[model samples]
Target: MEMQKEPVGDLQLHQVLRMNEGDGDNSYSNNSLLQKKVILKAKPILQETIVQLYSKSFPECITMADMGCSSGPNTFLPIWEVLEAIDESSRKLNRKPPILQVFLNDLPGNDFNSIFRSLPSFHKKLEEEMGGEFGPCFIAAMPGNFYRRLFPPRSLHFVHSSYTLQWFSEVLEIPLNKGNIYLAKTSPPGVHKAYLNQYEKDFTAFLRSRSEEMIPGGCMVLTIYGRDENSDSSAKHSPTIWDFFGMMLNDMELEVTTPENHKLSM
Candidate 1:
């Protein structure tokens, strides 16, 4: 895996930052249990929404996209859940299940090749699991920043995003959040303000871009990375797995900068 560089100039995070790729132990595919849980938790909402959409319009084909679909087994989780829901609905309503046109979207730096390579197996599994009664699925990749428009205007019928919205397109170069990596209790007021400003700006852009791309009556579901609404901001911002990761990074930095280590390097 390539080391992530701290943003130095005008370069955006989307241009440089990439998720751990390939199916190695350290790769995102092997270590995204948290994200997997999030996706499954939102299953009910996705099912209900799909059922409603199908009831309203008996379209021959349904076009949907899953933003931030990193490579691995989880890559097809949304597709499976969606097709299953539609199949159930179709059986109940005595209607034909619409064929799916899936767009899996992420940053250009994402592991799109790995996803493409597994397409054969994925299609085979879908066919085996669902059998001939199910409609076919056509999947394609859309590698780009979701904060910008990714699809043609008024083309997509549904959008699903899990654990993606909180990541800003560009890293802020503000000289703040020094002691901590993220907005923690130690983060000063200025640091907090800067992060909040960036969050608002990025989220607004995301909404605007998606709104323009989705067709009329289209719906979306997102699992945003955020603190609990009931939590007190004055207190610690509530701990996440990334907080422990920040601790490990800080320890590594201290080790690298110790007098013995620094002098030996010199």
Candidate 2:
């Protein structure tokens, strides 16, 4: 897929960028096993946050939000983890479990219908495990970019996002960044500056939006891919996969290059 320079508000482009539906070859449901691993890796952090919240004050109702929840099996993992932590804490404290209100968020173009299809089984399992202990639970979908607010002010108690915020909401295009895409070694200084500026802009917006929505004792667990600051080579860091992709593109261009074509293309 070609990377677009457009921002997240480009709804038409978002529709194209969204994951494939069903369990097909390119479907997120089939391809998100790695995402599941990321969620698992962050489980301990999530548990600790929940424990802290329970220790501080056990609210009568818990409001949780999972951002960038791509439609798939991994979509429900955060909710399950939260429920487990809440259950354990409640048992240890000998207190009644709180009513739960969970919100699942993603871009408007996400496969929400596909996600909804799996809810029947999700609710069934939750009921079986949490019957008579916890109050009635409600789950709903909130569709939009996480760089902006989705919930009401002081409504959310916890927010979770796994391996998602590493992506900038949009890439700033520079004429100097001609052949290569996304911060290549050969890119000019301006390109690097532009990327950093965009990163700050988007991330700042994300944090500010969450701040408005979360309660006083709220907590958020975010998992993102960050490069080692001491590493000079961009290819050796977290974007190694993208580096390989750029190499493949360069190779394909070389294969099509010839004396006559080279002069014409230039």
Candidate 3:
């Protein structure tokens, strides 16, 4: 029997997730001025667009899903923002907010305890804010990978994923004896090709699954990391918080796990 490949260690994975702090990292909060202008600015616009689409296409829709939701204070902010917009728009149509069914999805290893701990407060705030007129809010947790499938067929009205999807299942291959950092800088062609290959595969699967599970004309809003206009084609890695975590991995002497044998369950 073939031995199964060990899963990527959490510490190393965390590094990759937080690597955006390095110099030249446009993902840094300091870079937030510009990043905020181009990327952060697009979020509200996209949410509004989604709300408008829903109002026109399915004004009664209240079932939403936040895919790749990590547990934290930040996780629910965007969802709340979008919902608020939707609620306001519904008000214009003399319609009450539809009974909301929210599904929060993440990997099996995600910090669900923290998520549940924060949920009651989230619900309470919404209820109090809406007073007695609020529609029923049903929030449930769905633990699984996002690269495959997450929702019941034809169930969701709105789907959202933010700041995820830049992650590949594993580190890209670097030339031997060139050192990780050097290979990452000089061998741009190979690294980007690898990243794009994985992105296309994962992204295609993501869209396909969502298409199957979403009602026809249901809206989707996704916010992801991408290269700037000036990014050099030869640079092996883009700057982001995940790169900060990668630096930490180097300091801790951790090896990045390869992606070949690891089957991600979306």
Candidate 4:
């Protein structure tokens, strides 16, 4: 049987430019400039939360995975920070650091070259911090569609995905009509419904897959694009950088297609 072709959209294209720097030297710098502030502010909060949660359950869990770990040195920054926090916490409790199996996942087309280029530096950082006594840290790439299987059953102890789950394999388009007033606009009812439906399906699959591969008490830390605390369900657009990317995608001439629509379970 032939494998299904994964869907692509404006977000993927933008990522290509950001990762490949096809536009020129300044393209990535410009993009990073725009994202720097938000990245700095959010990294600590996300890192703290994931570390705290995982430490509470698996105080010595060394095996962890970062799904959708696109190519970038910055991508691993927060992950390492979280690991360091876990190490410190473990030492305080008089326990040896757990052996870490760091699995970095992404699409087959992702720029693994760049990721590999940064691996040595990451290892050196680990060596500098842990010296010879640091727990063994092994890094490997798991290339495939995350919507599908990515690891052996019941293998992972903790999982982390950031700003990635909001992106469905495809963007669902909502046609403008008399019944749908929010079509083509941000937070349009139709668009919101479409996005949520896709997210629900994908997220459920993600949870199920992880559940199978994760220990009963395994922890999952996901920082996704979401509506504001005060926003109602009627508001469709994410109140995060994803919203900006979505608008940019629309402007870049990418067509959004709505597949099967369904309600999502939180």
Which parts of model 3 are misplaced by more than 4 Å? 1-43, 58-61, 170-177, 181-183, 229-266
TM-score attained by model 3: 0.70
TM-score of each: 0.89, 0.87, 0.70, 0.69
Q: Which stretches of candidate 2 lie over 4 Å from their true place?
A: 1-11, 234-239, 254-266
Give the least accurate 10-residue stretch of model 2, judged by summed lDDT: 1-10
- Please, what is the whole-model Cα lDDT of each candidate in the order they appear? 0.85, 0.82, 0.65, 0.63
> What pairs collide in candidate 1?
none
Residues 125-241 of candidate 1 have per-residue lDDT tens digits of: 888987877889999999888888888899988999999888877767554566577767767677778778999998999999999998889889888878763567657456677
Best-performing candidate as measured by lDDT:
1
Better of 3 and 4 by TM-score: 3
On residues 1-266, what C-alpha lDDT tens digit does candidate 3 reach at each position?
A: 11123657744654345323322545233343442343346667766866677577655547888886666555566667766776777787777777777788876666666667778898889878866686767778887667777777998888877777766555444324222442245344665465567778878888898999988778888888776535665554556554565566575553333353234422
Look at candidate 4 and tell me the lDDT of residue 108. Answer: 67
Best-fitting candidate, scored by TM-score? 1
Sort by TM-score, top down from the best: 1, 2, 3, 4
> Against the hidden true structure, what lDDT does model 4 obtain?
0.63
